[model samples]
Target: MTKKICWAAAIYPILGLLGGLYYRELTKAEHFAGDTQLSIVHTRLLALGTLVFLIVLVLDKVFTLSATRSFAPFFWVYHAGMLVHGTLTVLGRESGAAIAGIRKPADAKA
Candidate 1:
């Protein structure tokens, strides 16, 4: 799979889950589920995360950027590359925690 898709597969679910949890926390909708309205801020944050990830995916293919290699000759590009990498890492972690919530139950025996 392309890097962007691979990365998004890993990232989007996490964003979804975090968005869910953050929604839950901010709204405390559990006690009264239908009473709480969805927060626009939460939606915006997740969208921003997705947008940043897409940018990273595009850069991965379009540029000669490396996550590790420093390019003092092209300081701006290097800095931008690093920022994208960092954003992806954070999104991936958030996604992971979110995924944990949706996993099937584990059983040792029938």
Candidate 2:
């Protein structure tokens, strides 16, 4: 449980950073002048994803929450939600690309 929580804490911040980069580059490439859903995705991942796991880690340390039978299922379900959100964000980009021609960050010129 400690290991799992630590991994989530580490992975989420990375995802948040990538989401931030994705938002910036994709918007710039598309010449999008208005606010975008992608713009807030990073903050969401950082705030919700990282923070929740940290709190869960501390609680597990104190309460041994993982000793309970339900903990495993709950953990998987919770992480699944985060993955689904990330997947949806990427899907949004793909659909938006079809309409407005979004470019990849790597393909953008320096």
Candidate 3:
């Protein structure tokens, strides 16, 4: 389980690279408009992904969560949620749709 956590943490750099690419694209665009969603994607991938992985690492080291059977399923489910949410965010950003009807009230009016 520790090995799995380490392997999963390895993905942080890749996500960071993707975020950097998104930032560059945002900067190069002629208009700063309609880039909010893209920025959200970049921020979510970098912040959530990295922070979650780090927390997992700390928890595993401090609490030995990897040794428990119950934790295995929870770990997978958490990561799966992250992947699903990240994919949906990217798609929603591209299509300008609210993901799972989750949007601010102001956004709904627009």
Candidate 4:
């Protein structure tokens, strides 16, 4: 189904982002601290993310479908969303402190 394929292509990035966050945390922990391994995760995420992007792009043509006006294509909406989310996930998991800096100010501080 064209719609299903579209949905899948779109979902991949979101999942990838979650995966990034998990990867980030896993790599940043004291027990798992290792640039080599961290790099590997980063590389994998980018590779997979890019693949997902390509899939969404190409699948549109291959499947001969269009997203509903009400539900815009995931590829378009999630392009940056997924990239940022995934990157942040990886970074946060690996370096929570870095992510903490980006979060909203603590209530006490605010």
The candidate that wins on lDDT is 2
List candidate 3 stretches off by more than 4 Å. 19-38, 68-110
Residues 1-110, model 2: lDDT tens digits:
79998898889889888878877786666666653455676887788889988998999999999899998998777544434433445444433343333434434587
Report lDDT (Cα) of residue 17, candidate 3. 73
Scored by CA lDDT, what does every candidate get? 0.43, 0.69, 0.59, 0.50
Over 1-110, each residue of candidate 1 has an lDDT whose tens digit, in order, gives: 24534466366557556755765664453443332223333453356456655665566567744353563243233223323332333333222333333333232243
Q: Which candidate is the best by TM-score?
A: 2
- RMSD to native, candidate 3: 5.3
RMSD of each: 14.7, 10.0, 5.3, 10.0
TM-score of 2: 0.54
- Clashes within 3 Å, all models in order: 1, 0, 0, 7
Model 2 weakest 10-residue run by lDDT: 94-103
| Local accuracy of candidate 4 as per-residue lDDT tens digits, 1-110 | 45655565566666656666766665566345433333334444456655765575575677644554633555355334434444544444432443334544233365
Q: After superposition, how far is residue 52 of candidate 2 from its true place, in Å?
A: 1.4
C-alpha-based local distance difference test score of model 4: 0.50
Total backbone clashes of candidate 3, pairs 3 or more residues apart or in separate chains:
0
Candidate 4 colliding pairs:
20-90, 21-89, 24-90, 24-93, 24-94, 25-93, 25-94
Specify the poorest-scoring 10-residue window by lDDT in model 4. Answer: 33-42
